[model samples]
Target: MHSLNRLARIAAVLYLLIAVIGPFSIIYVPSTLVVAGDAAATTSNLAASTGLFQAGLVGYLIIFLAEIVLTVILFDLFKAVDHTLSMTAMAARLAMTIIHGLNLLSLFVVSLLASGAAYLSVFDPAQLDALVLLLFNAHDLGYTIGIVFLSLHVMVLGYLVYQSGFLPQVLGILLVLAGLGYVIDSAGLLFFDSYLTTPFYVAIPIAIAEVAFPLWLLIKGVKEEALPKAAPQPA
Candidate 1:
């Protein structure tokens, strides 16, 4: 039981780390710097605040590492509920993390292009700016693609949590709803041109589900007696 609580706390802490870092790096910096649909303005903002852009990249790196760790820990914490389902969820989450890691390369290239390096004399300044905006847009799309896989992880995880009899069943339901929201959002982005123009407030309610999960882990931990006994191994 002690081990379970400790593991849950570690996973929760790692999630909180991403929560803090992700907003600053992914949303705050870009929103503050990049003026949407104005390539020149976006480029100017990035060029002016090069240090801030670099810091965002660093935050993403931490997110990548922390997400990998948290996913593995979650798999262990819930595996007893259903080994196959837990492994599936873990694999999906790992895939999402890997995709996000590759997406970071796009940010790196954009940063380099906008860094005002003398070697970039071959390209026009306006061209560089446009390219940077293009890459940033692509990064956003790639992140949404990753969220599709993450949704699968969340859906599977919800079932495991529901069956485990440890965490609240409502938490599981909320997780499933969150996963559904991701699926809808990702699919809408991929399929509907209008989705690009639409506001993303739908994710706000879904986020409550995510917030509750970590808080429960930190506060309630788990019901130790509700955990299932391990199956005996064949000799």
Candidate 2:
């Protein structure tokens, strides 16, 4: 029980770290570097801020590595509740992690095209610029696919947490809502052309759930008394 409490705190710290690093790479960098529909401008921005682009990729790599560790820990933390469902949650998160790792290659391609390497000199400037936009578009699509798996993971995780006596059930409900939000946003991103330009109000639940969960874990840890008692051995 003490070990579980310690593990919960560790998970909370890691989760909070990912939350901090994620926005810089996923939101701020793109908002700064990408100019929708203007391939040349976007390319130029990447070229001018090569350091920032590289840093963002590095941030993503950190996030990817951290998530791998966090996923394993979370699986261990929750598996006692319902092993099958916990395994499903872990597998779903692993799938999302794999997709995200592969998706980073697209960003690397954009970086290479923008670097003006001798080999890339063969391609005309216009072609390279267009490639940058295309690569970013591909990355965006990959991200949407990854989010689908993440939503599944969260939904299953919510169920497990809700069932587990040690954790608060309200946290589970919020997580379920957050999972729904991700699913809806991913679908909108896939089907709606205007989705990107519109407000992302649906994401509020996700932010709330994520923040609340980690804070609870950090502050309260798990309720040791609520843990299931072990059965006595037969004589």
Candidate 3:
């Protein structure tokens, strides 16, 4: 059980790193460079930017693998602890695992589609136009589905955290906030485009909390004393 917990913690860390750092490095850094007027002076600079995208793709794949491992470890963790909180937590984690898996798979497909569109664009502009439209529709659908699942998953996690004495209340609060962000973003994309601005910022801190709390719980085994127990029946 202890070993499983350790593995869970390790997997969480890896997932978090790949999810957060990879995307930030790949997208944020180069874009910042361009915006700051620090971009390279030649066409090569634009071409080189694709390297960051490739790196991010690699990182995303690694995150996908880590998520799968984390799911298994969480299942083991669920079996190790016998308590109401643990059971609820297990359900929440399982739900999130399934949703996240689907999201990752969708992301993989979207990435491939986008890459294909970009490659085809070089040879035929008309083909690129059709591909772009198809990609856009696919992306919108994928985003909608992913956000819906993720919002539910985050809410479940928040509920589990609130019930589990082993987990910090602040983490639960953050999870709730994150879930709210997803909800808002989804609605915004469906209705108004301006609503998305705040979610990006909200997501950053929430991601940190997600990684920190899970890692803490997995490493320390819920502090034993903090574990919840069944209440005594009236006699």
Give lDDT per model, in order: 0.88, 0.88, 0.54
> Which pairs clash in the backbone of model 3?
none
Which has the greatest TM-score?
2
Give the residue spans of candidate 1 off by over 4 A: 197-201, 231-235
State the weakest 10-residue window (summed lDDT) of model 1: 196-205
- Order of candidate numbers by TM-score, starting with the best: 2, 1, 3
lDDT at 116, model 3: 53
Which ranking of candidates, highest lDDT first?
2, 1, 3
Report clash pairs, candidate 2.
none
Task: lDDT for model 1, please.
Answer: 0.88
- Report the lDDT of model 2 for residue 93: 95
Show model 2 residue runs off by greater than 4 Å. 197-201, 229-235
Q: TM-score for candidate 1, please give it.
A: 0.93
Number of backbone clashes in candidate 3 = 0
lDDT score, candidate 3: 0.54
Model 3, 147: alpha-carbon shift in Å? Answer: 2.4
Q: Which scores higher on TM-score, 1 or 2?
A: 2
Model 1: which residue pairs collide? Answer: none
